[model samples]
Target: MEIKLEEKKIKLVLIILFLGMILPIFLTHQNFKIYDSITKALELWDKEHLLIGMLKLVIMNTLRSIPMYIAIFLLFDSIEIIKNGRKRNFEKVLLILPIIPIAYSLIKIFYDIQLPVGKTSILGVLWFCYYVKFDLKNITYVEKYLVFLSFIVGLQWLDVSRFFNFLGVGEITSDLNKAIIFMEADVIVTLICISFFSFFTLFSILLLHFFKGQEERIARSRSEMENRHLKEVQLLVHDLKTPIFSVGALLETLTLQEEDERKKLYLKKMEDSIEKTNVMISEILSVKSEKPIVIEEMMRFIFSFLSVHKNIEGITYKSYLKKDYKLKGNRILLSRVIINLIVNSWEANSSVVNIMVKDYKKRLIIQIDDCGDGIDIDNINELIKEGVSTKNSSGKGLSFVVKTIKEMEGKIYFVKKIKNGTKIYIILKGDEYGE
Candidate 1:
């Protein structure tokens, strides 16, 4: 099965490659007796047979290139996958399955050359790549490291006589073949192992950098999509504005013309509905728009908005307004703050939510008091934080409230807290209260 490569798996593959190279280099340098014995045999080999001598030279050169080729191929591909996610076609590394061992087998027929087990090494890695589907992001580092170690241990030392048979190469099983083959086997294996380790480690570092870079790209893409969606919604909402105004105007004209009280009342309800839609459109537009809102006028809208929820079981509200207060800020933002606080009180099963708008010296104090369970002592300190909501939602309501008030150059405080409920104070400059 073909598996798509992800960042973490690409990293693991690189580490396995480097480890494969490093361990063998260290082992060969320790004067293993096999190396000493292989040294004497290589010197005595038949330099007289021209074809065999040429084949031996070819095998040696090919063997030298194979490790470097594998390292470069795997390293470069892994980096490519990171930069641009999964590929549409097959990976290039699969070419090693047929090519490397077949080339080695040509030498095996005449010289009995000991080729590093390309079959096992490449197959093991490819098998892992296929199995992992290249997505190792969710796994722990320990599990990831263990898999890395297992690939080196299992495939690098794999022994199989049929590796030659699978490629349809005739194995020369004579005493001479065995002697020549086993003579350089240890040294060849050691060199391949060290090469694998050295290259794997070097490329692993490069893969890690690209992997992190891939994550950043994904995040940026997600954010851009969200921004585009927001823009589209705003445009759609803006398109809705004109029709809503026409409907509201039609309702007002009907209300003025109708002589019957019942029909006029119905028209009035329709006007209210259109006004609500208008306010909704205004709210959507005012999200990032800096618009001034009359506090007195906004309070009426808030009262109308809250009246819909007042009939909710156990919720009740009252308002005290001083009249004619104005503030320079986003109306939608101010409306959101009021609605959010009312919602908190409503959801808390408040028996009464008393809203007071007062003129105290040079400040307009809008206070809301709810008769329900008071704010938690511990939570009160963090109550204005985005996530601290009575309904246990995303908790952004109060945070938005605090932010909007700050933008209006205003202040808010939790003035009273008791067994019954809590009171919140919103204070704005008297200068903001225009004629």
Candidate 2:
């Protein structure tokens, strides 16, 4: 969805750019046409000048329309032709579609003209290419340049009548012969106009390339900074984990050796808190790690973790475990995910939480539903984004959960409940029962 939004913005920018490019041409054409009409009022408005003026208008209009033409083509993602429940071949259809009208138009305008109709409308195939996911933007730079060159050539071909006359190849009419003295002057002026416009287009392309280069450099810098920050974070997490491990081991030893009831209870609580911290630290560090874990053992650990939390101890809940399955991922990471979700539910002041685990043919589906004021529909998409949360905490829990699930090639999504709370569904790929 985000990618689609970005693409839409790009299209809008291109539309604005193309409109800007065409606006000047229209203004210039209108200004020149008025000036020329006034100056050449008494002069003979003969066949040659008429042809020249028409051809110039055609070329300018076609040039102005190029961007909009491409934009219109981009509006369709796919084009399918079906007849009698059978899909026809699209390749052949698109190749022939644009040429038919262009051929007719050309022939009607210039009965004696000759040009390759198929080759002239080659750019038209870009429409088909776009629909089939073969956009010009995806091609190599050199190939893109070649395509642009082809487009220029095609535009010239569309004005083949003027092109041939400029080349001194077309049949001469008696009316034009009478005005032959002015023909050389007209041809020279037309050539100059074409040359100027060509240079302008070239300059625009070069300017676009300069912008593209700057954008690429900025993207590269951002990627480098992200990589550096990731490395620093990994190092810091590793350093923190070493002391946490030692403390946890020492706490375990002390709790096992102590015999006094009050001291043992206090020690046990401390040990549980330390163990939870260790699990959270491990979750942060090894969220991407995929190790074999038994689902039943992980669930037992999750229940133990929840029992220690004061908030969740009083909440009514139901659990249905169809079967325990083996998954390949960090056990602590999954535990952290469940803990974050359960905590969120408790914070929402949910009276009841339902947990369901199902083993499928090739995946495991876990659903957690709560009966509190549900998440706002507007905030659903933003829930897993970093720095976004209902609680006033760091808001990294759900984000971390999302990242871990993605690393495991799993999916986590919200299923809106009918009553008041939110329902979160987690699907993880794993071996089917007895498979």
Candidate 3:
């Protein structure tokens, strides 16, 4: 699939080259009448206002260069799309293309003159410079526009009349003497423009390349750091299983020896809690595998886990199970998700935390509500983002929940605008549902 996409992009690049460079040369012919009109316009403007005359010249030249600009922009944009597959704003390209032709037609109708309107290979040198600088470099619209303007302005300073003369398409004017003077002045300006924009293009390319390199380095550093942190966590989880095993063994011994029924029950509950912890730790260390989990059994396990923590002062956990449903997921991981949410509610100073499960239209719904210092409405959205935390801890808990739920093809929503507490809804597909 990737190879096919690359082949398509290569074909597009070839088409753009043919249309932008080769086809233009074959279709366009030198229009001396356009040149005559430009020189006359410049001569008239010079008599009225020299500054405005030069400005008009620059504008006319830029107008003539519009098609080339469009082609260059398209080529640059297409290359970027091919390399990165990220879409860029081509609105400027769209807006400019239609507007230029209409503007040129209006000018021709109003002034009774001809202007260079079609593509030409005359600006081939400038296009080459643009390709060299921008072909592989990612640049902003502002930089593109700036360089485009510079290219237009720089072309005005070139001795184009001399260039035409060299190509055997010399002066159309009857006065050779006037053309000689114009050519001499144009020579000096041409040399200066060439030196200036050449250095400008080179400097811009180098600066952009440097910034791209710095960004890539920063990304690599971040990835390496994350990988190291994950490895450390795996080692810690591996170390934790030994102590948990010892606790489980001790609880088993106590349950076997206890004579009183009440004491035996307490020890049995402890053993069950420790066993769940060991399973959770194992889940963390192993690659994920999903199986059908009966919702009632999962909730019972969660209730047991929460009951063990009920000794904490001023906290109450309530549950409402409307129906039994079967869901497909990692049971230990899913239980941890609920436990994490309940723990968060407790830490929020919540006096009561309610867990409710129901089935709606073949989907399983789990809602958690807490009345402690309910989450601030403003921070609700930020809560699920990795590294953002209201409690200033690692902030991975809710992010983990979100990721796990997504893996199970589930959706989670935080209900803002609630009267006095945080309300969360988790919706997932159910394999089976029963009353």
Residue 334 of model 3 has an lDDT of 87
How many backbone clashes are present in model 1? 12
lDDT of each: 0.56, 0.58, 0.58
- Models ranked on lDDT: 3, 2, 1
> lDDT: which candidate is best?
3
Q: Candidates 1 and 3: which is better by lDDT?
A: 3
lDDT of 1 by residue, 322-393 (tens): 455565667766787888887787677786777777667767778888887776644554767757766758
lDDT of 3 by residue, 65-139 (tens): 544455555444543221132233343233334533454355456554444433223453434444444333444
Better of 1 and 2 by TM-score: 2
Pairs in steric clash, model 3: 350-372
lDDT of 2 by residue, 1-435 (tens): 011123554566456445634443343445446324322422764444544644444454445445434443333322334453344445434533553345434544554333233323444444344333322233344544443443453444333333334323222222232343344444644564466546645653564455456657777887899678777887888798888888878878987898888998988877887777767666667545667777777877788777756665555444444345677878887877887888888888885777777766567788888887777755654777889877788888788888878777787877667888999888887643444
TM-score of 3: 0.51
Q: In model 2, where do residues sit more than 4 Å from their true spots?
A: 1-230, 241-259, 279-287, 314-323, 432-434
Error of 2 at 266 (Å): 3.0
